[model samples]
Target: MTAVIENTAGQGTNTGRSFEEIAEIIGQVEDQSRVGVCLDTCHSFAAGYDLRTPESYRQVTADFDRIIGFGRLCGMHLNDAKGELSCHLDRHAPIGDGHLGLEAFRNVLTDPRIDNIPLILETPDDTRWAAEIALLKQMAL
Candidate 1:
């Protein structure tokens, strides 16, 4: 099973608001090898892990690797955020159309670390899925 962390709404009481907390939850699982994480881009950004720049992306992924282990990265939810960094809002915008921008999606779609995993698009408009998928496929090239 995979654990998909939810947004904390900037409140202090929620779990899985940070990478450390997610790691903690994963750590407590009995069979770690069978479990993994489904990282939602919007939620991660809302929780304050910036993916808007290459440097920030590297830092954030490195922190995840260190804390949660890349082997546990099973899936990804590709969505843009409507809020600013650390805003803690769960709002999901269409791909390449929110605060995350197209570049961030480009970088992520091309990353080999997640090559075989599922990349689910949770963008707002169902009509845009084909175009968005095409765009992401192009970005992977």
Candidate 2:
């Protein structure tokens, strides 16, 4: 439980290393077992990986491919950040309430590679699961 909590809290806060930078560090290991980049909308937005526009989304993804090898990105922790990209604020808003908006979620869900991975929500209210899940479902391809 402590590990889970720590990991959750740790993820919410930017560890300073960029996604690609983290992948490089992880790649230094001898035996990596299908390492994947998990992008929390909050962290990505807070870290400056803007996905609000189509061109911006493509550019960000292209950069990700260059820096970390897109194949290594195996999962996503979908959450909306309360701050603008690069702000580093740790607040998490509901799916569409934050800067990401609904289109960003739609764009992510359409990606064939990412579609099948776990899109877990670590939002503060689990009771709102039904509505959040529905919103995510609507974003699905």
Candidate 3:
């Protein structure tokens, strides 16, 4: 299911509705198209999903499995979060300097399950991209 939160600002407001209601709508959609989750780090962080600490990262993994299912997660846009956890602020910075630090991203890159997935950094600058990619390469398992 291609689940996009309808209200851009009020992202969590969908929680008010029951999961069945949400599932019903998703069921009606025709195009299966091998549904995949786009893990936009900025959006996940902005929408109150913490990917910083190991425990938080584990929680996020579990939540993704429970809510969206791991089957759909084929790609990620790995940008740095500019604001603090649960801040709901959607700002993107260079890979390592922002709120979601390089260590956290290193941990993510090391995860074996996500190793095959495409991780494209939508960070600020080309220079930052080179640095981040180098950092990622160094950290890769």
Collision pairs in model 2: 37-73, 46-86
- Which candidate has the highest lDDT of all? 1
Once fitted onto the true fold, the runs of candidate 1 whose alpha carbons sit more than 4 angstroms away are 1-12
lDDT of model 3 at position 103: 69
- Per-residue CA lDDT of model 3 for 41-95, tens digit only, reads 7667766667788888888778667765666666778888778876766678888
TM-score of each: 0.91, 0.82, 0.78
lDDT of 1 by residue, 24-109 (tens): 87778887776777888998888988888888898988998998888877788999989888888888999878999988887787
Off by over 4 Å in 2: 1-16
Error of 1 at 18 (Å): 1.0
Residue 81, model 1: Cα distance from true site in angstroms: 0.7
Q: Who wins the TM-score comparison?
A: 1
Model 3 lowest lDDT segment of ten: 1-10
lDDT of 3 at 111: 84
List, in order, the clash count of every candidate structure: 0, 2, 0
Rank by lDDT (best first): 1, 2, 3
lDDT digits (tens) for residues 50-91 of candidate 2? 888878888888887887767666567777777776776667
